[model samples]
Target: MTDKDLRRAVLDELDFDPSLDAGDIGVAVSEGVVTLTGHVGSYAEKVEAERAVRRVRGVRAIAQEIAVRYADAKKVADDQIAARALAIIDWSVHLPKDAIQVTVSGGWITLTGAVPWRYQSRSAEAVVRQLSGVLGVTNRIAIEPRVPPGAVKDKILEAFRRSALFEADAIKVTVSGDRVILEGAVTARAERDAAERAAWSVPGVRAVEDRIVAMARADKMRCTAARIRDRSSIPETNARGTDPSGGRKDTKCSDRGACPVA
Candidate 1:
């Protein structure tokens, strides 16, 4: 498809989603890359916007330049946001009690703690980003492995074998200490994501470096483009919260417990 057609498709996708206001959002396409610009009311909306663009066909990559802007009436103080974040996290059934700490500065929250599982660490961030006036979240939570590195590799490979999504032999797994590096190529982005998920599902994996690439076949590309066009006509339920920068490097927790507002 031409860049002009791709741009129109992206804009239509963004507008069709009920979860976000696409009034100020701009879409510019070159080749197959989509560049998003402008501002949104919340970080969640910004993320949803990007997701909408990705759903369109012919989108190879994205450059997210959308900014988060909170209205004055909805603006919340740092201390208030911190307190609310702490309360919500503590109340969550998925997270460990008192295992995560919250720190807020200028509407941004930083979570610091150590969890036995990657899901727990992600859960802590997911609950807090939905709070009012949260501009962004910096998840500094660390993962503590419970098994040997060798076993971790075996488990990850086993996971791939058990799943129908992966080719098993097509993907290569490299384990260094508790970190896993996945190197391979798949036909769709979902498969690459599945490989990463499989790697993280292992007991002793503390980190995952996904080097998998998605190379769509000619027929698959045509199907994907058709699917994008079809989906653009339908509306879906709204889900909240997102992070522009997918993940962060692990950092030592300097301020333990609930931190004071800065």
Candidate 2:
């Protein structure tokens, strides 16, 4: 079958609402793989969108570029799930609470910030995957360890002693409970990435927020940095497009915990 026919077949198989805001769906075909792009409102719909495209007979692989937009309640639920997942990872000793940034749009979650491991990279994704409302995730977190605090400077010194990616002495680390904070500077992006990975490997860290400057400003970085509390998952079962929760709530806890009492 022709590629156009194949694309059509893919769209026909998956369950999608024609009335929904699917105008963001962008379709491109190369070889047998189909790349799907667009802003969806929830993770469930995003998955369903991919499933719809995947069912097409000639498609061999799918590249999902679809973003989840938190325009209402369901999207808000997915965002909370994303936040809780990151918080769980932050429970680690080496992971810093401020080091990671989590955002959920619709059901698609984007993770930015830094960590210190290849395992942590996968670990972060695994945590998010278990979340109830997640549809897909984009992980753009970097790994690189900084110098440890004076009291534990030896630990930082030991962490990157043999690494070519870090200057070792140029960065500093501070830890409180499981929250880790990295300070100081690095001359290159690779060093920054390596240092983040090392910090993530340390035990008891809950999160990390890197303030290190890159050697050069990098583009091609996806714009997934969103204010998690500012958006809500507006349910799809509507005609007037009015948010029942009166827009996004200003609380950190979502469906995973008690909704904050006003």
RMSD for each of the candidates = 16.4, 21.3
Clash statistics: count for each candidate: 0, 56
Estimate, for each residue in 63-105, the C-alpha lDDT of model 1 and write its tens digit: 9999999999999999999999999998999988999989999
**Model 2 over residues 161-218: C-alpha lDDT tens digits?**
7677767655666666445666544444456667776766654344665544332212
Q: Which candidate is the best by lDDT?
A: 1
What's the CA error at residue 73 for candidate 1, in Å? Answer: 0.4
Q: TM-score per candidate, in order? A: 0.75, 0.33
Q: Choose the strongest candidate by TM-score.
A: 1
Quote the lDDT for 76 in model 1. 97
